[model samples]
Target: MIRVAVVGAGLVASHYAAGLQRLKRAEIEPYGVPLAKFKVIKDYVEEEVVSAYDVDANKVGKPLSEVVKRQLEGVVPVPPDVPDFEVREGVLASSGAGLDKMFPVRGRDQKLPLKEAVEEIAKEFKSDNVNVVLNLISTEPAEPFGDEGKLAKALERGEVSAGQAYAFAAYLAAKDSGKPVAFINLIPTPLANDPAFVKLYEDANSLVLGDDGATGATPLTADLLEHLAERNRKVRYIVQFNIGGNTDFLALTIPERNLMKEKTKSSVVEDILGYDAPHYIKPTGYVEAIGDRKFVAMDIEWITFNGLVDELIVNMRINDSPALAGLAVDLVRLAAALLEKGVKGTFYDVNAFFMKNPGPKEARNKARIKAYYDMISALRELGVIVE
Candidate 1:
């Protein structure tokens, strides 16, 4: 069975759990999953959320199956069998301090050293089963804890991001158990992209997939650019942005946090176009009433066949979290399958298509699709997927 651990038992995590349930029951009309033929859904139904972590006092000690009900109010139905495990406290740095004003979040009553915290959480799920660490925490700006030496020193201050600490924990757990593990980063943190962080994961033999999930506008934009590029269309300028009312949006009202979101959202633009096109792509605002459904608008202006100025305007209202949750299902399953094939570190085949800022920073969408097909072939070769 594929066991999973969630870094935060928040809305997106809940949506992911719900999506898993749909797959378990063979009901998936709700999640508009864009996969061509995910024969892995059956394998995914074997999944179980074995552990979850959160700093909210109310959530820390509760059963994940129970606490995630809060997310049900947001509209996704929760599965009764998602499994209930005690939510543990995760390590958090100043980046999380800002959220306290908005929600009642409290990390370990007593701050634990970084290594201690990593070990603390790692001990819970170190069995022989495959594990995937999913980080769905609110977006926040953070720097890598750095090399093992620097991370060791930083831990002395007991200030490390939920992303870094959890990643380190997965590495330790994978090393100790000699089991294949994966860290699926659904937020805008750089675990997979950070050089020092990737080295740590690679050294420990754990697969790390991350940066930011490309569920809505971002991935769509990549494809649009690829279509233009393949057809030899010159792109003049593009404006892409989204606004939503999720707790994440509330946290992003902070400029530092918004900048973190901006960097990932814009990371794909120039790469797919082969050069930097003037673009303003980022989270433009927060509208609480809209909740998890985000409004996305994009205007692409480009030069056409005869040097004529043409524009492509698109708009969408998407249930952002669920869109991401759908991709999460594929990522975790793919990670488990990749590990069985002796591959490790960043899997751009999945990351490039599934993430906003895939590791290595750039990929054209058409190339990503080809890589994705190649990955599927590899999976079939390894018996990870079958018709």
Candidate 2:
């Protein structure tokens, strides 16, 4: 069983916590392969919210299960132990890169330094393994420091973002344990993609995967691009965006933060299409009236065989937080299982299929398809579950 310590125990995490508990019941997975490996997902995979951190006063000292019910307005299905699982105080480093306009801040007196933060969090669990540290924090202002030396210096000066702080802590804690652990980023900020952070994880021989979790529009777009390319269609331009009412959308209203999200969303086009496709893709705006449901719009215009102009216009309204959280469940388990075998760094199999701009990206459709199968094989080889 994995004792997960979730940072930013907010909207998305409510869905992640509730969804994992729900999936623990016997049921068929709606998608993906290696059904043989997935058959025992419940038995080999389980999560206890050993600790959670959020700046919101209502959430910080409460049970994760109790908080999720309020977040989703009684729509969450929480397990018995979940209600007793305490939500610890979280440090909003630099107030989460100035996101206080949307999220609250916990007291400085209650938090510790980067290394102590990990040790303190580690002490919260009775489970032998800390398993994985999942960062579900909102979009934040970030800059890739280029190398470990600069990143370490910046971290010492407390100039890093909230997401970076949590990642550093997770790596340190795993190193201290002298056992396998993982850090999974479900947000758009760089963790796995950052060279400095990747180096840190490798030095510790732990797993770090993500930059952002691709749930709806992004993955669909990737597959569609593959279809057009295989058919030898020349793409002209594409436009896609999502507007939602969640706290994350509110946080993205900041230009610096929005730029971070846009980078991840837009990064896929050039690599996948084989040439730069003039595109506009990002989290466009926040409409509080929309609540957790997100509004997505896309326009793809391209040249097909024989000089014909074809345009694909699609509109969708999806339940955003829950969809992304469902993807996170699989990634966390994959990271945990891989770390057990001393496999560190990123997994393109999990990254390409699950992330928008997977690291060292395998943007081609054929490669992504193969990556999915490879992920199943890797999981099965670990024997975490059996058919």
353-381, model 1: which lDDT tens digit per residue?
Answer: 67787774333433455546776776677
Residues 358-378, model 2: lDDT tens digits: 763333322355556776676
Output the worst ten-in-a-row residue range by lDDT, candidate 2. 28-37
The models' CA-based lDDT, in order, is 0.76, 0.72
Best by lDDT: 1
Clashing pairs in 1: none
Model 2 CA lDDT for position 368: 53
